[model samples]
Target: MFSNWNKWSIIVFIIALLIISPILTIFYSAFLGDTSLWPHLFSTVLPRYTLNTLILMIGVGSLSLIFGISTAWVVTRYDFPGKNIFEWALLLPAAVPAYVIAYTYTDLFEYAGPVQNSLRTIFNWEGAQDYWFPNIRSMGGAILVMSSVLYPYIYLMGRSSFLRMPISFYQTGSIYGKNIFLTVALPLSRPAIIAGLALVLMETISDFGTVDYFAIETLTLGVFNVWLGMNSLSGASQISSVLFIIVVILLTLETIGRKNQRYFEKSSGQNISSIIEAEGIRRLIYSFLCFIPILLGFIIPTSVLLNFVLKGFAVINFQEIFSAMFTSLYIAIISSILVISVSILMITVSYFRSNKFQKFLIFISSCGYAFPGTILAVGVIVFVGLLDNFFKFNFNYYTGGIIILLFSYTIRFLAVGNGAIKSGVTKINPNLINVSKIMGFSFIKILRKTIIPLIYTNIFVGVTLVFVDILKELPMTLLLRPFNFETLATYVYQYASDELLEECSLAALMIVIAGIGPVILLNSAIKKTGKIRKSEPLIY
Candidate 1:
């Protein structure tokens, strides 16, 4: 197999290694140093961090599933008043970073914040001791804020999966007097739903902003505490190793969930799904339930930020923030392009030309997405620092040259690109590729003329997702960004950190605003994919 490997296989193999080098460096650093600190770490904070992390993952996962699946189910199955609005509005929270949600909700629900202030006004309560308002800085609060922002991952995947489900399956279930959700929809969409849930769980465990803000001692926060506070890179790498293990477990579960996929694969050209029209109270109930997530995720926080902007505009330097916005757009756009380019090459090569071992390496390369951004940043810094001894180059050359940040973004977001393209590629008939090869079409020509044109929608979606993710990314930008360089995420985080979130409201709003196009485009893409799938059935 090794002797027979072609140029495409070798090239993709190298790219995969380069992509995952940072992650490999993390493991290298963990075992490279003395093992003395392990005892103290385990004795003191490790168990607590592990417990908090597990608890947070479970809480956020459950809540996000409820919000994501329920809303997705309601929209896909039931026709209601706000179905159209909810279709896209439900995805809005994805634009808001978990930390920003943490900041905004605290402002709204805290003792002196508007919610409690109004409560005090209405009930004439005096101080914190007099009234027992829920602390928005607690573990529960962290789960709530993170769930609100992260559910969109599940929602997007679930909705797309639901939309892609064949109508005949539902009709057959109806004839058998089966529960559509349990008997049909759930089974067919389980793989996609699980993939989405895995992404959500990974996002939850890898989160820094929400956990840090709430002072929750998850593994991610523990990484920072050890790295920055205790000044132990080895200990930080150790904790990051734990996070990496968790990501592996989640990815394995995702893989397991994808098993028996052949059983659910329908070889039908009819891609239509039946939407039930709810009558009277059922309609109202469906509409109300669907709106709950949008309220928690998008409406409330956006309102708070908008209020902040209205009040603090006089103090804001629009010039500075706008400059940062352009910089963010530039970097995000370029980085997303690079990530998608690599994703197309790797996934196509893996799917078509590579052996199983090489394919596994390509797959593992995307594990970067599930690592905490700070942890990934550490890996990048370490990996680059090692190279700098010979290459005489560093990640932070200057603001004008932010190549390292672009590379980091590529590593972090390559999974999104891969997932998008994979979804498209899998839908393509294998016969098409076989016939192309039979006609003496080279791999490059087939990919360019056949795969790329066919999967342009997936490519577009991948680009949009990576672009938005880069814009909303915080920890990496905060760590790896050069001095005097600011993205919208860092801008919002800076002011939010200083308890002056109002000052950077416009930037925060822009981050949310930037995603609106993508969300709408996503909605359109799902609808469009459904139509496309009708014409192209699974070839058994």
Candidate 2:
């Protein structure tokens, strides 16, 4: 028994150390003081980057909340025309990457594009000063494009929380003559809403493609500019440290905000509230409200890409694009497997066998999710560079290779897998493990025969989410891919960055298409899990 305990303890320690290595490397580089660029950055661009980052976060967070919560409430509480379609359709945007949407929007709305050109022809204006037009490559444009794609995080969480709430809560609010939504639903759903908003904000802060494409001077952009342009890895690390601190604070606030807040419904036998069907003008309004987000988020961008493909504008290289697509799927599958396996082991040890110090290490292991991808990629570079230097071996040869890329993905996405698995772990009864042990079942035997079967749904969910994320992942793949490596994301980014969307529309569309299957499967798994739990007694 002691041997088994020691074995798992050492395994968990090593895993946590591996996960936290990059973060430590970044902090070490930051304090090395090798660069003299700090003063210049402070005087010129740092403040602008900070301000732009804040504005982007606030704008995206607010808009995503509004879009996600409104749609979630409508879908859960009220029935309208095409409500069934909207139920799953709202999640379609989650498959569309923010960067792809940015490119498609730019293609459709830029001066030489269809929208502006049609406007010019209609107004009979011949010059630049003919009329006013909104630029799709500005900060505001970044917010809109990002919020449209990211809002589904909030919607999924909010809808789930609403579905789980007992009907009694709403009935009580009605009896007290309070607005059920404002008084009961929103407050009860605060934790879920905040959890989703936190994810949105993290994604916004970590985004490189949209902000870079729009030429927004956010800190993420600043990281690359300082690293590659100025030849100052240390300065870049320092900037990343600042961004890292900001995300940590946000995450901490989210945790503290939920402290001492708990919800309990007295009755477990009550069903959730029935949906109210809309009629007449209300039906039309509901339909339009639901239609707007899906149109902006999924339909419009998809149609624009389809138009590009149908018009024979996109560069067709079926052999090369197909090779890249397969490569992407290969890596996503392998990395998802690796991440989920490690996440299960670590979470199991932390929950069942670890002391305070070990648990703290597990917590640190998950912090990589809070760092921007580029920053995390840079951290991996620094850490690997040190290893190469210590052993007098070259690491650059492997820089863009699959080995490094997969390692980076593991570090960046471990938190996602951990969260999904940890939630599943909590639902399990501890006494079952004790019983199995008393029956002479070893830890490994219990895990394989008992725990694994029970958590299969969560494992599938985690794998699907990580797979979708890696498929659409850009910044890390951009920085760390092998010299000739080109995933679907990097493929689209190459042409999109050059403002040659016509050349990459097919690839861009493929990324969205690839994510759709996994996302739909994930939602289905979640719904099935919810149904199973609904039949059981409520537990905190």
Candidate 3:
């Protein structure tokens, strides 16, 4: 059937197959072992795990919308005091991981912590009988923690949508004595909100650190427990299949958003006019609105970690910490380079050379990112183990699993690289690729000589972002790393899980610091969004 396909198309298809092979292995491995565990799982842990996962997704999704949509609307709609500062500062929380924030909140709100202690001092009450305080380890707490860090996805997307909407829409709402937000802005911004919410929900379901630390028993955590606690690989894969279904639905939501995005494309280059001039009480309210999410997501957690570092700075374990830091940086850098290389090849071919089937395959391959890290790790391990068995080499998990890490990381982050490459490719002259083809140059030669140089900036952006993501990654690094190997993320996880968070505070802080670069880039991009006008082509 494919005999007429060009070499480039075949090559792209094979790469997509390699990228999707692990996901295939996951479904295959689910049926390989005992079939009896399914009843037990469904009766006991599976129902609870599934319910908790849904609840977490709903809770986090709702809260992220409130935080993200509220802040986006406030910053874009009202001219409040400190409005300029809030635009960029609101994104700071994206730098902190959910698990890190969970650790910080646990200390701040626990029974023996300063908050309860202060309350006790004021009310002259003592011990556990005094009053009821919310547990930071409960379902509600998990929602709060996850939402704080994840809301930036919605904020960024929604704000861009709001800015792009025609001012006439809001003006019409106002002329009719309607709330512009409810009547116009919110309605027009639904696609962007759903897109962002899909991302937030995906992050919520994929989370292992916060759910695991809080003992919430989400499906992601169930995969972990079933695999390690019960030593049943098949059982883990079955749970991962459920998580896989959730991911597919989220992808559908994203697709719907993307399809409708063109409908709201900015029609005019005019700036969005602020409807409300925040002053006095309104200014205070709007300012406080922006402050809360920032306070919860970035400030409190960062401050807690900073306090720990300051107190422990003298006796910090510089040797071990430095080693783990180097390891994390090394793996992240190498994995980013590989991901970008494949991304450039696949995206260039898909856009410039490949047919529809090849483009579809390439697109499908990038969906690896939608899988939870644990689910993807299980898939990768099963696939790699099969390869090891067939090859009969000394490449077991104990000795040579770095290859597994690299492979899995490539799959997990390839979408980030592809997005960047696609953005860059869109701006280049398509005639350049055609001219090379007319001269009888192969696709590879044209790609090397023409496409790569034009996209260097985008390549740098993709690699930098992916490197930071891998640096902060926990589930895959926790489960699939070579024996005795540790990244800074795993290092922080180990110490924090043992209630020695102070020991790992420095490493955790470093991860947060590295993430700030992406925030800076995003802020710069947002600044330029509606400012410059594209010159119309005279030929068109």
Candidate 4:
């Protein structure tokens, strides 16, 4: 029946199936599970898991705001030494994965590591008991590591909002004796800040890596333990369902909060807000504050990696490393295109379809990003297993399949693509579509000739960002790869699993290198888009 519909309808259905499959699988398993186990879970480990997840979310959320918002404010509002470098450098941490940072931190701070050894030599300390250092494998360490890298999400969004604000707002705040930072900037940018924080929180909740490395007893870890340790995929699915519920609730709250508050520049005269120059001691302190996040996020870990590479201590497997890099790039590119295209289609349909049911369906489709990658991979496996079995019973297919994993990745990464494209589309005046309609253009024609051309750059940036994200993805790829596929992320995880990080440095660094292309492209696109928007003169 849908065959008569436009190509977009087919596209939407296909993408919807991809997004819904894993969720349906989880729901199926939840129904099948002997949830007599729930009582035991609640009595035993569930409370601790919930508590740890909450603490991690709160800690990382607050710290990332401090790191992300402060630097964004300073760079956008004030002119100081190194301000130019800090504007871009603050984003470098996004190129590094939280898990990779966790591994690097562990190596640098462990008992046999150089920091403790150097201190031992200097202080003539005897052993572990002679002097004390906080273990890097703790909750606090996970917070520090995650916040270091994840703050870039906030910084990106927060900086964009801060830069787009009209100078008149700040001027009015100054006249009213308001603290601009606390009263004007913060309140004005709350939507963007909350959106960024929502992304960070979803990432933190769905994170299996940092928590696993730190041995934090969070819900994600519990999901894994229940699935693999208890040999029960159903129990695992039930837990993942819980995680999904938490994410849905948070996203819902965000949507509700922003429902009544519209953030846009009403008087658009291409006004550029002039930066305030800091003088003397204040300037020095501001520079120091701006330096801290990037220092911890990029410099330290990168310096350690460089040391390993330069000391000739790490062997470079050029052939194997090159092969993994190629594989990673190919997969990232393919998945990125698939994800961004699907996201744009979904967002477009949601905006123009005018049917509430269709809009809600599109919204639900993007929600798959909330699942932890490994758990979602399992859902894909279970769902595809059922599909393959049915096909074999009727026609002839099997559990091991190819498109299954790609479908999973699209489901898992669509939210990032959706968020990016949605942000861009939101900036455009909705009346443009109405004007096109009044000019006798069909919806698809208007979308093709108008909306697509207008948001083409956002689509590109979204694809590139998703490409980089896929390049760094580990758990889903690990669980879902065909018999012998190896991406850089999986390659590094294997050796790093054995605590042989020196051996995996090439692959680990390759993940960063794979990301650099997309990161550069994204920054350039964002900068160019801002410039174009700024150059357009406003009408009275």
- Compute each candidate's TM-score over C-alphas: 0.89, 0.93, 0.95, 0.87
Ranking by TM-score: 3, 2, 1, 4
* Tens digits of per-residue lDDT for model 4, 18-112: 67778878878876756777777889988899999999999999999999999989988889999988878888888888888888889999989
Model 2 ranges off by over 4 Å:
1-5, 257-261, 268-271, 393-396, 426-446, 525-540
Clashing residue pairs for model 1:
none
Give the winner by TM-score.
3
How many steric overlaps are in each model, in order? 0, 2, 0, 0
Reference-based lDDT, each prediction: 0.85, 0.86, 0.88, 0.79
lDDT of 1 at 267: 56
List, residue by residue over 1-540, the lDDT tens digit for candidate 3: 334377877887888998899999988888775667888999999999999999999999999999999999999888988999999999999999888999889988998888999999999997878788899989999999999999999999998888766666777788999988888889888988999999999989999999988999999999999999999999999999999999999999999987887543234444355456877798999999999999999999999999989988976798999999999998999999999999998998788777777888899999988889999999998888788789877766655779889999999988999998999998989998888989998877888888989998999999988999999999999999987898999998898899887889999999999999999988888877645343311110
Model 1 Cα RMSD, 1 decimal: 3.4
lDDT-wise, the better of 2 and 4 is 2
Per-residue lDDT tens digits for candidate 2, residues 358-435, read: 888888888787778988988999998888778876445654367788889999889999988998998889998889
Tens-digit lDDT track of model 1 for 109-174: 987788899988999888777778778999999988999988988898888777767778888899
Q: Is candidate 2 or candidate 3 better by TM-score?
A: 3
User: What global local distance difference test value does model 3 have?
Assistant: 0.88
Question: Candidate 2, which ten residues in sequence have the lowest lDDT sum?
Answer: 531-540
Model 1 global lDDT (CA atoms, 0 to 1): 0.85
